[model samples]
Target: MSDKIGAAEDPLPLRWLDHVATAMNVTGSSLILALMVLIGLDVAGRNLLGAPLPGVPEMVSLSIVAIVFLQSPQTLRAGRMPRSTALLDMLTKRSPRLAAAIEDVWDMIGIGVLATVAWATWPRLVRDWERGTFIGAIGDFTAPTWPVKATIVAGSVVLVLQFLARIWRRHRIPDGKAQ
Candidate 1:
């Protein structure tokens, strides 16, 4: 492991962002634990008796997306995103500035993509919220769909902000220490 445990490189702007992302991560983690408990109960119910949790599968399906999006911005912030960097790696030794520029370009693209998604999803979220749309058996075990859609919008906005923060942080890094 790298032996650098000092405060974040750009701590001020990111402090709030970090806290928000951490909160999102905690929320996602709690959901995961809840899912496990739910699945365990479901399995026990199925095996011990003939009845099982209604809409467990549906709940899981919805939660999977929520979990992924919830955790993604934090993952991106951590520099843990799984990206193929063969070209960037090669460029780093030969042309560090170029590599940094390319990385910035990628961040710009990411910002645009994320912004577009947030834009697109907002209307759907509003419609769902306004209409009180839901999923699963209507009267059996329905869950409000807006919350998940809102999560999507929130996650997308966080990612966009994170990408912007990354770009800002990148520029703040000294010329010789750009990484």
Candidate 2:
């Protein structure tokens, strides 16, 4: 028990990444709560006061993307990302090593996909930040677009790291136990 606890307590980079991903997940949950509150208020105002909340539409649109990005890293880390696991499950019963290898390759592909997304997003993030780009009308409820862009980029990078960590962990364990 002590050994297991100590092993878990070790300050490894992958553990640090897990901590970061969990923190981001919590932030995403908080954002979701905030959005719910905002939406509820908007509905109440619209029904009772005959006036809806300003910028609610824009905020929802932007926040939807940010929330997905914010929560994705932890989702992947937790093995909760949606996928067809039927083949892997069948293969794992026959050959754990082969299944582990396939899983690692999948993680590699995930890293590549996320890296490409981050690469594409970086220039846009910079452009938005530099130009002070916003999503709302002038002299009204306006929010900077760069924050959402930055969140996307950051989330992609962290997800890539999580993928790498998964591969690393797979290799560290014996083949039969990898599943």
Candidate 3:
């Protein structure tokens, strides 16, 4: 709903994908809030009770990566992805078609990069799942790494899909749908 581009302009499938991305973004934001609370509690515990949360540091490390991946697609779809727009801005004034073409190319490159990241993460995810890989001490708090790896792969795929959607949106035919 925070998207700069209106949802009405998106095709049904793209709209569905946007919904998915928005849910993921919400989940990421919730995770951030949880982390903040956990850190605050840990600090309070340390200062007041002289007992800190055991897995706070490890949880924070894992959550940071999860947060970034979880929220990326929505960030891009909202037109909040950080980039210099000097060239595109100038190009748009001169030729809108050329600007769209250049944006499509840029999106294509984004697809490649995210796809590559997902492809590379797939094996690690499998390995972690199969081996039950975990972080933290043996007798203390421990968390499976597979979930985080899975998040990375899933997020990357969604991000690639978002990039493809961007390209498709740019190249839609006169019928108001992608070819």
Candidate 4:
């Protein structure tokens, strides 16, 4: 584990999480591209032949949802989520220790919120699966939504773990240096 951590500036677990996030983002991008191409082809076929593509809207909608959920973890890992840094920056300038403590507390609260939301929504996801909900023009195009919901929950879990890792690394660092 130490060797793995030493191989990268980040801890091993965090690095692995980052890798997963990156992969997911790439996959999501690919899906988006495919969706665009599909839509373009469908439009061209309809305009040229006067025959509309069946279930194109439905497929695109599902693909968009998947892309959003799948890319969430990568966004979080990149620290791109919006946050209020006014108070944090002020505290950091005044007292480094207090700033660190506040940061840890903020991370904890974020983790708790994300975990609780994921936990609460999990049952609904299962119920949706059990009920066999389908979204499309025809019922035959049924694709289970549970997998996308599960991806969201999994992304939150990964974010929580990443925050915890950040807290741990912060403790390892001295007063004014990187860990």
- Output the number of the lDDT-best candidate: 3
Q: After superposing candidate 2, which stretches have Cα over 4 Å from the reference?
A: 1-11, 174-179
lDDT of 4: 0.72
Give the poorly placed runs of model 1, Cα more than 4 Å off. Answer: 1-6, 9-11, 173-179
Each model's TM-score? 0.90, 0.91, 0.92, 0.76
- Candidate 4's residue-wise lDDT over 33-98, tens digit each? 998888998999899998767778877876776787678766665666678878877887898789
lDDT of 2: 0.85
Residue-level lDDT of model 2, residues 1-179, one tens digit each, is 01111135334887788889999999999999999999999999999999998899999999999999999998887778899989988988898889888887898899999999999999999999999999988876899999999999999999998888777665654435543
Worst 10 residues of 2 by lDDT: 1-10
Give the winner by TM-score: 1 or 3. 3
Ranking of all predicted structures according to lDDT, beginning with the best and ending with the worst: 3, 2, 1, 4
**Residue pairs in candidate 1 whose N, alpha carbon or C atoms collide under 3 angstroms:** none
Pairs that collide in candidate 3 are none
Better of 2 and 3 by lDDT: 3
Tell me which of candidates 2 and 3 scores higher on TM-score: 3
Candidate 4 off by > 4 Å: 1-9, 84-87, 174-179
Global lDDT of each model? Answer: 0.83, 0.85, 0.87, 0.72
